[model samples]
Target: MLIMANNFFKPVGSKIFIINFYTFSKIENLIVWVNRSRYKNLDKIKYPAKAVIIDFSKCKPNIKPYHITPLACIIHEYQSKGYVIKLKNIPNNIECYLSSFNFQQFTENGSMIDIPVSSDCKILPLWLIKRNTYNLYPNRAKEYFENNHFDGLSLWPLSISLAELMNNIFDHSDSPIPGYTFTQYNATQDSIITCVCDFGVGIPVKVNNYLQTNNRGKLTNTGALLKAFEMNFSTKSQPHNKGYGLDNIISNIKLLNSKALIISNNVVYRIFPDNIEYTSELTVNFPGSLFVIWLNVNNLSVKEEEFADEAPL
Candidate 1:
């Protein structure tokens, strides 16, 4: 449970500890781990240091977009603060997943990990995208899935959604950190999941800020997040920024009877065919935005003209 480090000659020396969260690897688990009393009291490892090792060997292998986005974002936040985060005892599949995206390149003492030859699922490796490169997402994403033989109709909506979501990162996040995007297709389940994450001022913060600046009453974090999805709702004042991106994403996903999850700060807004759900019960400590969409490959089709002129690919 405890790993030791030595600088025996110095009066004050650094220590190293292995962090093992003895629970299912959920985003909330990572949140609680990282946010627990400077990250010391959570594991009760006693000695605190600038560097730490996270042991993911015992974690479940069923990692999802929702989990990976927050995990990567949290690590990015820590690294930005000069913390040395090291990964150890990673499950092979998880290691391959992280390695496929060049994830280790950004971590301390991390190296390139080879993916297994037996892997069958298709992956669009996680990308760190900035304003200059965001426009490439839609086209690149389209090519990736199209080349992989996904249905054209399904991809149209996905492409449009990606364009809007990617644009939102640079236009709205207002953070220097590049946004993260990833996609994975599970052939066995006939489903695809794509996610976008950014460590910028969250949607709620931006909405409340716009409200305050305009001399309007502020809404709760959850309320502000809901207001964000309303058609024509936006914090941007530009004439062409129509604020239809989130609304359009919801609309497209509904057409396919798919699902989308949006998280800003502590609030979670879920869009599904049956109903809309919003909650603050999840212990998400992220200060930016995370969006994820799930669609079944078999359930995708385009109603003629809905996405005709907007198909960039």
Candidate 2:
């Protein structure tokens, strides 16, 4: 039986976020009320516990000023702990969202498959496919690249790197929740903005372990991230884990004059067309890793046949 340590409530802008679980047990009707919080983005804020409750009995069919992906990521974080997500009221759309991942009955009654929040954003399904959902990485990349008429080189890395990205989630992320992949084709920027996210054991832990074995001093999360881009560095113990996927992403990013950024734990690494850089100990520690790649297709012209020598994903 989990008991709240004390009565604690955080004033998130105008909203209230419970910090202490003292009242968590008394939350017969877990009502989640949100207003324009100081930071509309929940990820920017911090929480103290693993599981959260929501009572959507009165949630408007359409709720505005809500952040979907961030909330989803939070749920995934809790899921890793096998936390109980008690719900008093469940919405149909919300059920669909939760079902995208996996959930069993909580310590308290009620388990809804719907995702927490509902959004009108078309980017949801396209970007938030549950982990290991039919091995759709190849099809997803093809759809995005071909729809935009990107060069074949773009397809190669997109397909290969995306697969590697998903594989990393399975390989390193200890969470059972599937990783989520997001892609936004920004015509104005003339680039494919892609992000793969999961709330699991972040990159720093894996990289540091490898460092420990290789006699390298323990590295900060940032150091581990920066090192990950170099060729032949990997944390996988399997013989075939060549640690080649992300490096390939780097190679393609340069070939296309693009950019890639990987954020894990408290470190952030970026690779620009001209240089690669990293920053450590961000204001907040991300519960997991977020890998973002920008493929600038402004004037790409490489052909598919030209990428034959690339390794299999």
Candidate 3:
């Protein structure tokens, strides 16, 4: 079906024709009737400079119909670029599918893809743990808290903790060597626990090398992990190392009110709410380091409570 504009007085003037596969005989009749009366002059109709074509023959039968508002906006944008658009061959099945599904139904029933989570509740391989990339973990956590009708503050600490852990994995680990593995699980009744394990050279070995050069001699990995938190104790000398990354992590642990355990070179440095303790027994079977963090998701109060009574005095 074609709707054409004719200008008899100026045959060479601009003309517009709108064509469609479906017939609009009644609409055409109405237009003819109007033309015979008020629109007797062909110049009365304003013609748009551009046209747009939408083809749907290759679209799936189950696919929803395309919305026209965005298409209209696109046409307006292209008109500014001095180009005309023509929409052609729209599939009948697409229209039918769209008509069958309402906006609410589409929003509610759409498939949400699954995201990978660890058994320890920590997302492994920080590179793979993105907010929107996999199941929207950040927003999902927010929505969960919202649905439970809790204050908004419960989710922010955990989010910051996760970001810090992931950032450490990326920045501290020496690449070219296979990186660390991350895992998470729920612990006790109110805590979410996560662990990051790296098989590369352990923290103790790095620290020992640094100390040895400074004439402090060889130190054990357990000693290294503990000393790693000491302000200004860094592997890089002079202006090369600011020695603040690990120290900052230790400081933030208090701010976040979290617990962490580092096992390296057969030694464990466990930091609880109050006391920081060290043990010589190396639980790690490999040459890398393992950091396990426990977050209290239920009661996320930044205020320092009395150190847990269980911490070694």
Candidate 4:
């Protein structure tokens, strides 16, 4: 009986034993059914369960396969001891976890699919130009040219034209409300159209102010624009070379093969290489100026045909 009980309760390798069970002869077969019943209950009790604790301070950002020292240690210890350890509260660092373990098994089981860093698109705002401020107009124009990759020859004419136009804005207009704006639109396969505008007193109004004091008071906006074209007619009351800038602008427009429109004092003066004409109406609501230039950068006409070929083939 003692041998049977010892075989049943000794747990194979356990040192636990009852001291009084050593003596007895027929005890081996006695209560054998009860011993079997008790052995079945003992089989339900699990031994050597384990818990793994993880520390999170050594994690790095934007790297995968996180190194979990504690969990790895627990796994090693439990495997050696013939037991299993369950890890809890895995850190939110995904790259760390993925790199440390073959997370493909977990991911294949429909675990974590939404990655944090993956995104669709990003947006940014457009830059603006301020007017009436000296030095800024040229700086902004240079910036525009640089951003668009315009060559020195292509940039120079426009820069000169803008400088002259802005000079007029400051020199002639009374209470000049200075502001500038530019908008670009794709026109065709080889063409881009851009419009630049400013909210300030117009040229015709400034010319009319000069004319009004010079006994030419009844002159209209069209008359002012035409008179501005004249070599000697100027808005400056002082003895200075006033109309030179306008004349230079007209000459530069012809040289560059560009067109311009000057709207002021309820009139529009369209200036082109072939014709200089005007229309009268209060179309401009505020006290400002607008200059629109269209450059056909991709057009064969502007690129190849516009320039003279060197000698022969």
lDDT of 2: 0.53
After superposing candidate 4, which stretches have Cα over 4 Å from the reference?
1-133, 139-147, 183-201, 237-243, 272-286, 295-313
- Which residue pairs clash within candidate 1? none
Off by over 4 Å in 1: 1-14, 17-27, 34-52, 78-85, 96-102, 105-121, 151-154, 237-243, 275-284, 302-313
Query: For residue 237, what is the lDDT in candidate 2?
Result: 39
**Which parts of model 3 are misplaced by more than 4 Å?**
1-151, 154-164, 167-172, 175-188, 213-216, 236-243, 255-257, 283-285, 302-313
lDDT of 2 at 109: 26
Per-residue lDDT over 1-313 for candidate 1, one digit per residue giving the tens place of the 0 to 100 score: 0111111112224366555523334445444543442332323344455665666766677777666665655565555556688888887887887676555664642212122111333777656565456677677777677667664454777788888787778777886566677778777877678999877888889889999999999999888887877888878834435647578888888877888878777777787755455466464565578888887677777534445666576
Model 3, span 85-148: residue lDDT tens: 4544556655543333221222222122134322211222121332334234434543444334
Q: Higher lDDT: candidate 1 or 2?
A: 1
Cα-based lDDT for every prediction: 0.66, 0.53, 0.43, 0.40
- The whole-model C-alpha lDDT of candidate 3 against the native structure comes to 0.43
Ranking by lDDT: 1, 2, 3, 4
Evaluated against the true structure, the overall lDDT of model 4 is: 0.40
User: Against the true structure, what is each candidate's TM-score?
Assistant: 0.75, 0.59, 0.43, 0.43
Per-residue CA lDDT of candidate 4, range 1-313, in tens?
Answer: 4454545333434322111111112212212312332211223334222322222233334321111211222233333333333223345665343433343232222112221111111100111232324445444554454355443324445555556655565566543233332323233422223333443456677777777787777566677766776765567633334446666666655555555655454555566534454455553232344454443343212222345566667
Each candidate's root-mean-square deviation in Å?
7.0, 10.5, 24.0, 34.7
